[model samples]
Target: MSLSYAYLLTQMVIFIPAIESWLRADPHEVLIVTTIEWYERIKASLETVDDPRVIVHAIEVKSKRPGLIAGIQRTTTDHVVLLDDDSIWSLATLQGLLCGLSAGPRVAGVSNIKVNIRMTLPALAPDAPSMFEAMGAGRHDRRAATNTAMAYFCDSQITCYTSETTAYRTEALQRPGFVEHVVEDYWKGKCKLSSGDDGAITRLYQNGRKTGIVVHDECAIEPKSKENTDYLKQILQWSRSEVRQLVRDPYLLLPSHRRH
Candidate 1:
């Protein structure tokens, strides 16, 4: 259908401003996918333009992966960009990410933050080095080399950034395996979901799949606030459950990866 392009947004109250940034920044034909509750609260904040380019979907599903992947699948777009509740981007950053995806087939992902090209570390631990650092656990301003495995590995680690604004190509990202990482359930009074999309993508790339990054300094991020304390507790509980299950059967989520 005209080689459509779209943007996916997970919402809460704070992200309304960021959504405005997205609506203005992404190319025409970009769709915004958000929870029904969130859409009800935030949709009105966006000014109505007669432009048929923006479409909104009311998401009933609570899990991040299913809902987001479903949104991507529903889109007629050839390219899809993903954003979280806390990320705000400049027009330049948005264009750069899209252009990076348009670069070539070998590039499966595009990162919006600064990236450190020369470092390696394990996947999934707080101690893991910042995927954007110049070196593992060290910061430097050096530019990264082009198309190296280590360069791709750095891209993989960045796949773990749950709250940061990022975008993806739909054809490459909609695989069933990638959607399996979303975990969701009611923790307290409110329905909640934990994001594991990036982590799963990181695992795929680390397993030798190809991906890429678009480093831009102007892209800024706002921290996500856990407004629902009970939801936070539930997330903690779910994480513990996942760890225990993984320990009992290493293949449950992470395989050949040590608990420590």
Candidate 2:
């Protein structure tokens, strides 16, 4: 029952809180993998943690996928928990993930539902309506409906596992070509993909003989939201990934072999 927590860190401010929360979950070890530049800048802050279980690994490679793969390779635990730098999790969430994996040997991975914080603007005056309210009279209703529809679709059809807050049996992760399979874009004939590692990993495990689970608990992870230009860029990147997945692996769209 050894557990290793691995985080691919980009922003130190957000990652610090995420790491602190994960530490409270009491994993056997914590691996923080980041770029060498970031590691040098945040070395002092990391040194203050003073935990023998925490190990910082800096790589010359500057991509998230490589850093994550490197960190996973260094894990010495039977179970590995993959986390994004901006994701915040609770101890209960950690336990729930482990419990889900413990349900059966064929369970390759388990991930919790994710909740994104809605971005809103402050009210201009005491009598002013809130930003969401100002969107229109029925905007809230439409938003609620959309949320429900997406949630239903995710739970019922898709492989609801994302790297933001996922736990995997190390055996599944150690499968031959797992890392390269996730990071490479075969459809577009690319050496490396800029994003969509989560989707790739989910599809990989789902296509295997084993199954994956999405824990229905309060183990919701909150990832930092992008704003303005960054938000648009993020949306574009996700859209590209989705298109690529659909084109390359249409079976993911089928409603089969998913565990809730």
Q: Which stretches of candidate 2 lie over 4 Å from their true place?
A: 1-10, 116-157, 215-217, 226-228, 255-260
Q: Write the per-residue lDDT of candidate 1 for residues 1-260, one digit (tens) a residue.
A: 11121223333455566555666774646466666666655457544443466566766765566556656667665666665554555667667776766776656666555333233435555555443231221312221232232345443323232324555667666666555444333224264435445544544544434455555555433333333454355355545543443343344233232121
lDDT of 2: 0.64
Candidate that scores best on TM-score: 2
Q: Give the TM-score of candidate 1.
A: 0.57
- Find the 10 residues in a row with the least total lDDT in model 2: 135-144
For model 2, name the residue pairs that clash.
none
For every candidate in turn, the CA RMSD to the true structure comes to: 10.0, 5.4
TM-score of candidate 2 relative to the true fold? 0.77
How much lDDT does each candidate structure score? 0.48, 0.64
